[model samples]
Target: MMRRERLRTSESPDGRKVATWRLVRSGARILRVQDRADASPAYRWPGREPLPLGAPGLVLFDELAPPDLATVREAFPGCLDLWNAVREDFWHALLDTSDLPASGTKG
Candidate 1:
């Protein structure tokens, strides 16, 4: 299975943080890091706001499942490379987007 997950984060010039994720394909119960990108943190929670991690090596995702184009678009609207990566790399069979809302709208 291939997973697109947070790898690391960096502080932007303005003191805000930018998170980056990598696409990893795992076969034997192991995850190997692949492609990566830094994107705006626009993923949401129903009632809680996203906060900075209190420690290192912590992980969070906008969606627990494979990220849909809309979710990515919300965070990084003009990123063509990110669009292509989500379109081509993530294995849809491993994803269940039925529980997700339609793309381009808020949760």
Candidate 2:
């Protein structure tokens, strides 16, 4: 069976952290990209089990040292819009690949 892993990273400018749920199959390919938009920096993971489907994955802030949500919102009010565009771009790219199986089963 395949397993899922959660990878977290913070972006600059508005130091809001983003979490991505990835699944690594038997090979080195990435399988899934689940975004969490409400995760906090204080949350800790055991690195043993997969994150729940409804768990928070990403956090948006303005600073790394002391995240300022208001600042983030002020600076990047369209962040969610941009994020959604990027996600769509990625999905389209994956679908454009010819190597993907005919059954539409991606791995």
Candidate 3:
């Protein structure tokens, strides 16, 4: 089946470290990730809609800066792409191996 890897930011200029969890599941599997820290009072709401598949990555900021979509895009290119690519690859592999679906469908 699919193999998942968790990734975190090495460092940020503001000293905030972003944490992410990656899931590699069958194409048929659905995964979701959330950022509880973002929901806390310390962050400025970005008004951005939650990702269609939910956030597969969680980021923790040390301060109350508004959400920077651009910075997020630049910082976690691989992680963002992994959400779909990894899942597709794993799903195909699993399908090739067996008829059963993935057990861990949610992130």
Candidate 4:
């Protein structure tokens, strides 16, 4: 089976970056564009597993750090619909988890 991996980056309070290469074994709902968004356009496999939290890791950025829809779309075409769907899902999920009504509906 072809192994799929995802890159996750987090910054510490200080001016340091830590990158993690997560082994995304399987997830049907996980969007493919997420991979493009997390890593640079010329991303390549690091040839090894990520280091521990205390250890250093390589940090990579997409074409744009905080990519806008246009940037993301430009990087990977035909992702507009997918992006919108994911955004809507996240919005609704946030509302549901926060126990908030769906705007027009009263709880």
Candidate 5:
């Protein structure tokens, strides 16, 4: 299945960059995005599983760093088009997904 994403970057307290690619579906429902870092932890990370975080969109981020305009353009060739489409499609996707039951229990 195909999912969507957008880039995010921020500065940490120590002046280092905190970069991530946010996961969003058509309706702008943000799930989760892993950090843009390389790691060799004891367990496999989110994107390393049988199905990666963003599915078909996984290839858009092969670089080991956060995405900039240049990187996005180079990766997708027409990044603006995809961005605009995401803008247009986000709400509808959310409404469609809202039909499903919420995941966690309220107790």
Candidate 6:
């Protein structure tokens, strides 16, 4: 099992909401940290709000399930080295933590 902790939540320099999370697998000293953006400014259509980038450890869009390793690899084909270091369990846990609703949000 892994533990997920929210390290910080704040607005990015461009004003998009952003957050950081810490992931730790049980009985392991390795600490994995990931950052998430609520939306991506680089890929938004004109006259529309930006959507989540959905990249590994990068953009975590609300209303979307955590992406799988294959998806991350496909999105960032150049980041072989980085993806190699990610564990499947950790990735799932990381995004699962992010998928949680805001403190006061209701279904």
Count clashing residue pairs per candidate: 0, 3, 2, 0, 4, 0
lDDT digits (tens) for residues 1-107 of candidate 2: 31132222223234443323222222112222223454523222222234444345533221223222233334445555434443443344434535445574665
Candidate No. with top TM-score: 6
lDDT of 6 by residue, 10-107 (tens): 32344332333234332111222233432333322122343455443444422223334455457545544444445443455656755556689762
How many clashes (backbone atoms < 3 Å, residues ≥3 apart in a chain or on different chains) does model 4 have?
A: 0
Model 4: colliding residue pairs? none
Over 1-107, each residue of candidate 4 has an lDDT whose tens digit, in order, gives 22232233222223232222222322112212323233333332222333243122332233222343334345545445554544454344434434434568645
Query: What's model 2's TM-score?
Result: 0.24
Q: What's the lDDT for candidate 5? A: 0.35
Candidate 2 vs candidate 3, TM-score winner: 2
Per-candidate Cα lDDT values, in order, are: 0.37, 0.34, 0.35, 0.34, 0.35, 0.38
lDDT of 1 by residue, 1-107 (tens): 21233242232234333334443343111111112233433223332354464233222444445343455446445454444444443444226455355689655
Candidate 6 overall lDDT versus native: 0.38
Please report how far candidate 2 places residue 67 from its true position, in Å: 24
lDDT of 5 by residue, 1-107 (tens): 22334443232233222223443433232222222232322212324443434433223333334343334434444234444443344444445544444579331
Preferred candidate (lDDT higher): 5 or 6? 6
Q: Which stretches of candidate 2 lie over 4 Å from their true place?
A: 1-40, 44-82, 102-107
TM-scores for every candidate against the unseen true structure: 0.29, 0.24, 0.21, 0.27, 0.26, 0.31
Instruction: Please tell me which predicted candidate would have the highest lDDT against the true structure.
Output: 6
Name the 10 consecutive residues with the lowest summed lDDT in model 2. 23-32
* TM-score (C-alpha) between model 1 and the true structure: 0.29
Question: What clash pairs does model 5 have?
Answer: 26-90, 27-90, 27-93, 27-94
lDDT at residue 24 of model 2 (Cα atoms): 27
